[model samples]
Target: MAKNMYSLMLMDEVVSQIDRIAAQSSTNRSNLINEILADYVSFVTPQKHIQNIFESISAIIDDVAALTVQDMAASSVICIKSALSYKYRPTIRYSVELFSDNKSLGELRVTFRTQSAELLMEITHFLSLWMQLEQHYISKFDSKDSISYAIEQGRFKRTLMYPKNSSLHNSDEVSKAIADYIQMFDEILKGYLNGEYNTDADVEYRYLNYLKSGLTVI
Candidate 1:
């Protein structure tokens, strides 16, 4: 979206109301007015689009998991909380920040936290192994062309680029992708922790099964 400077005259009462709402929403007067006009014109604002994406994600994972949204400082940032299937039920936080110019794609940061040092160690090792497995997995699906991942400590971050031409541009598809990725991560981590999957082949098999199941299972 592009911006242009425009001068407008508004009634004092109307301006006051806008200011009140803007204050409550933690946004400035100009941005709030822009958002209001965008909504009135049926122009999908980036904030609304990202909100829809997060809502869709919550709906999809509700069947087999829990989802919670955290208070955020800005509309551009969305934070979601969920639990993994690991012992003690480690929590996972997903923080998505939308690009200012595009609403359909953003950077997704996944953070896993647990008090157990043993579990933390296992998760750290699993993250490294996951990178290798995902290299092949991504190449298999050809999705590597648009997405990339990096890890540090208990965090795994992904840069999502959903071009307008791709299926991921669909909000439903984007939600499914997020849900599936987190579910798969939890499952693979559990498998490793339980000693059910140790080798690359075992992880590969698990990943295949996960995809074949249409990402419906835990």
Candidate 2:
């Protein structure tokens, strides 16, 4: 969306209320007004599109026992929290933020905080392996250049790309793909750390099976 500056005259009371609502929603006055006007005009703005995707994801994950969706005031972001099946049950946070531009879909960030050096090292290793598997498998259908990844001390981030199938024009399919990916990642990571997955080949087998399950990949 191209934004331009324009002057419009409005009542002080109306502007005040808009400001209040914008503050509550964690957005600026201009953006709130733009969204309101866009709604009135039956136009789907980028923010609205992101909101629809997030809502669909929330609904799809609502029945999953392992994940809890947290309410966020911002429309562009969704935060989901899950616990690892390890000592002290450290919590892992998955934050998904969609972009407003067409360059890319969004970003998925997995973050874990722990005081145990061994646990952190294990998680870091798992994340590295996860990236390698994704690159090896996902590259068969999509360009490896389309995706980007980063691993920090306790956080891993991956850029979400648009699905190869152009027929998926609705938000529901996109949301389901993202939700399923997150669930698979969480389950696999926990399994690897809990010794359920005896070797890297075991993890690769599970991931390859998921890719063969005919689900949309992002």
Candidate 3:
């Protein structure tokens, strides 16, 4: 039996960066990275097969050209593009609401086609960086686009990052919003599998562990 599928090491620079990001974002760094990992799932789709599947779902959205497979060469493009945009950290969860399907509140597990281990690490790295930035801005820092300083007075009003807006807001509101996005993502996944699948619909899948750990955005 293999033990510990992944290894962990502490680098000083990473820790320092994490601290700075944590201070700026008002997140504790660990949570920030977790959020990023959750969002990366949206980008996990392969380039080649996306169109074949999307072509199959053409009837649901009533797009006549969707059946043609000509436009599908637009690799990595999804019909619900915005749902996977992930502009902000929390927005990943918010994306679940865009779907029309209704799945029972159980669990679903789906797999992406695999090509060994090359791309997964790259995805993880990019997502980790973005997550740190999102956490800092969304939770801790207030941004300013324009500069305001007194040059003539021989004094500089340093740009300040305000620390406000603690995470004391209502919990239920957040939960419902997250649930909506999850539902929408589920709907999209259900649609994709139905289109692409020839195997049994009830097949047990290992991807369910992801939902249990945390959801990711593409």
Top candidate, metric lDDT: 2
Q: Give candidate 2 regions above 4 Å deviation.
A: 165-169
| TM-score of candidate 1 on Cα atoms, chains taken together | 0.80
Candidate 3 C-alpha lDDT tens digits along 107-208:
112122223244334223333432343343333333222212221111111121212332312223323323333344344333333443222222122223
C-alpha lDDT values of all predictions: 0.72, 0.87, 0.31
Q: Is 1 or 3 the stronger prediction by TM-score? A: 1
- Cα lDDT for residue 55, candidate 2: 93
- Residue-pair clashes per candidate: 0, 0, 13
lDDT of 1 by residue, 1-218 (tens): 66788999999999999999999999889888998998999987766776677777767766754566677767767677877576778887878776745433678788888888887887777877777766665544543254578888788887765543355555677667767776677667767777899876797788878767765221
Error of 1 at 197 (Å): 3.7
Clashing pairs in 2: none
lDDT of 1 at 61: 62
Please identify model 1 stretches exceeding 4 Å from their true place: 71-73, 84-89, 100-104, 140-146, 163-167, 195-200, 214-218
Sorted on lDDT, best first, the list reads 2, 1, 3
**Over 4 Å off, model 3:** 1-115, 141-172, 180-218
- Displacement of the residue 19 alpha carbon in candidate 3, Å: 50
